[model samples]
Target: MDRYIPPVGRWKLARRTQQMTHSALRELLKVAERPDMISFAGGLPSPDALPLARVAEVTQRILHAEAIGALQYGPSEGYMPLREAIAERFTRNGSPVRASQVLITTGSQQALDLVARVLIDQGSRVLVETPTYLGAVQAFSQYEPSFEQLASDADGLIPELLSPAQLHDVRLLYTQPNFQNPTGRRLPLDRRRQLAQLALETGLLVLEDDPYGDLVYEGGPLPPIHSMAPDAVVYLGSFSKILAPGLRVGYLVAPEALMIKLVQAKQASDLHTAGLTQRIAHQLFTEGFLEPHLHALRARYREQCKVMLTSLGLHMPLGVTWTRPEGGMFLWVTLPPQLNALDLFDAAMQAGVAFVPGAAFYAVEPRHNTLRLSFTTSTPEQIRRGIETLGRLVTARLSGLS
Candidate 1:
């Protein structure tokens, strides 16, 4: 008999599928899993920080008392109690939000996907920081928007640099103002106000993705840009960073008018975030377990950040530079101009250290002379060893040694 052919060869993929490529960071995560490797690549919370006991108790209580509803299909908007709880928290934080305005998602990543689906069209202008979150870029790219790189400095996005032309025909400004991913740069309060005012003046919508807002290790968190102009900014929050990421629970708060569309998009995406996980998150938030847990988490991450900073200071070459992040898991590193981070990856891998290169974080005009290191997952000793290994590689490269 003739060889049988599979129909997969004849199937045509959607144009959006072409934009979906494997995440460079995720690929590094595989290498990170090897026991001998010291990885600063993945943006992971410390395993020690997970509230295993509390989560176990809560999950057991729910399953014992409300098993049927918890396991059943849920409303597309989300579990109502959790939505109310989240609304109350945001309102207390200075952003007055209504429960009706909240839409729970599979994860904050799903929230990003939903926002892109509802807002972006082919050729839409999307403003993003120079080295923005790669995950957001990945989510937004599928919709085929034209990304405009906003100018940023060491501290993060410069709101003053936003010109009138940049706002013209812009669909949304996606930002992680609080301890932004890859760079670990937080926007100052003054800039937050400026950004809010700019959005209001230009009638631009801002997507404030604040997964790391609660991870503050120094000083305090500035009021969110969403709080400054509640109607103009769509805010996304997550339990992943502070709590466990395995649950895949997150939410977005939008003005009620726009929220309806987001809810519809979410329904089309996934009926709702899992009721069980939503309930678990809500119970943790309302029962007063989350705050103390966060306190412990902040202290743990603070020490990790300190260790990484101290190690980098002691070992890195004279021309090498890195951000001193007050909070958050990752920090950006700029190698000497002569050294390219991508070129050093293989050697670093062989040397048993792994980090995400800065080029993967960019939407356009990637800088090969940079990389990102996450401090949360590794121990202080591992961080010191990893940085020492990386610094040696960088030094050798600058000296024209392989």
Candidate 2:
């Protein structure tokens, strides 16, 4: 019997850009959901760190007092009060920015997307750190920019390495600048100034995504690059790490010229982020709840970082290099060149631990020998167990390679 199949017409599909799909770090979190798997893959703030009680209280107040405003659609630029609060936060951090400069986004992820949409044309040249935030790359990739990876080290992006030739046609330079994701490297004060100077000299635009700055475990916070070269840098900040990620609240600070364009782009994107979420975030900030809350986050993450560091010292093989981050959710580990981290991932997963292969974080020519291990989500005991398992896997692989 012949089976009747539907006739296939020419497939109407997405553009070349849309055809590419990138997986999120959260997808690898499936391992943690299994109860048996200990995850070192999630770039998450500690669950215990979220100000749930405060959020619940503030949310209840917002719903009861301003039901219509909370539930109804908000201005494309965001609720004014929240923008003011965000602006004040920036000023308090030594970056004197106005509320008009702040464009509330669903998350910093949205800020990155909107910036990409507004600034990037097809095939526009863009500069990124050697191993930067995978999410930023995913967001920017939709615009089809030609990514030029700049070399970096423990201090973050090397300013001297960014040549004038690289700046010629580059539309934007994307950087985390503080407690960078995947690598957990912070750009030092000197380098931060140098970068600002370079941007000023070369006329390059900078997109500064800083979600983890408030969670600094040690050292005084440096002024944002935007503070030095306000016109050249587009600053992205988030309440996710300090307050709660579920709120999905973040903001972008751009020069008036750039923000005007981004506001139109954002309005067309999501109408606006949920009004209730913005209201709740504003209430928390205005009611003076964030400072102590941030303190708690710092303390907890510091202890967790220590746990992971101790575990690594005890378990990791000699000659393996790993970053010792002052603050943030991750540490980047570079294995011996003979060992391919992607090849080792399955063995680590089978042994009940999971981490992100660093190759995925690179925009081009992935470094197969590196991987990112997150320490924020797992417990100390789980960290110890997972690292021990990972260490054994590495030992066996290295031995076989030898």
What lDDT does each candidate get?
A: 0.91, 0.87
Candidate 1: tens digits of C-alpha lDDT, residues 1-402: 633433457785665676788888887788776888898988998988889999999999999999998999999999999999999988897778899999999889999999999999988999999899999999999898999898999878899989878798899999999889999999988899999999899999999999999999998878988889989999999999988999899999998989989988988888888999999998998998989998999999999999999999998989889998888898999987777898898899999999988999899999999999999999999999999999888888877853
Model 1: per-residue Cα lDDT at residue 254: 91
Where's the lowest-lDDT run of ten residues in candidate 1? 1-10
List candidate 2 stretches off by more than 4 Å: 1-11, 17-19
Error of 2 at 390 (Å): 0.8
lDDT, residue 283, model 2: 91
Judging by lDDT against the true structure, name the best candidate: 1
The total of clashing pairs for model 2 equals: 0
The C-alpha local distance difference test score for the whole of candidate 1 amounts to: 0.91
Evaluate residue 324 in candidate 2 and report its C-alpha lDDT on the 0 to 100 scale.
90
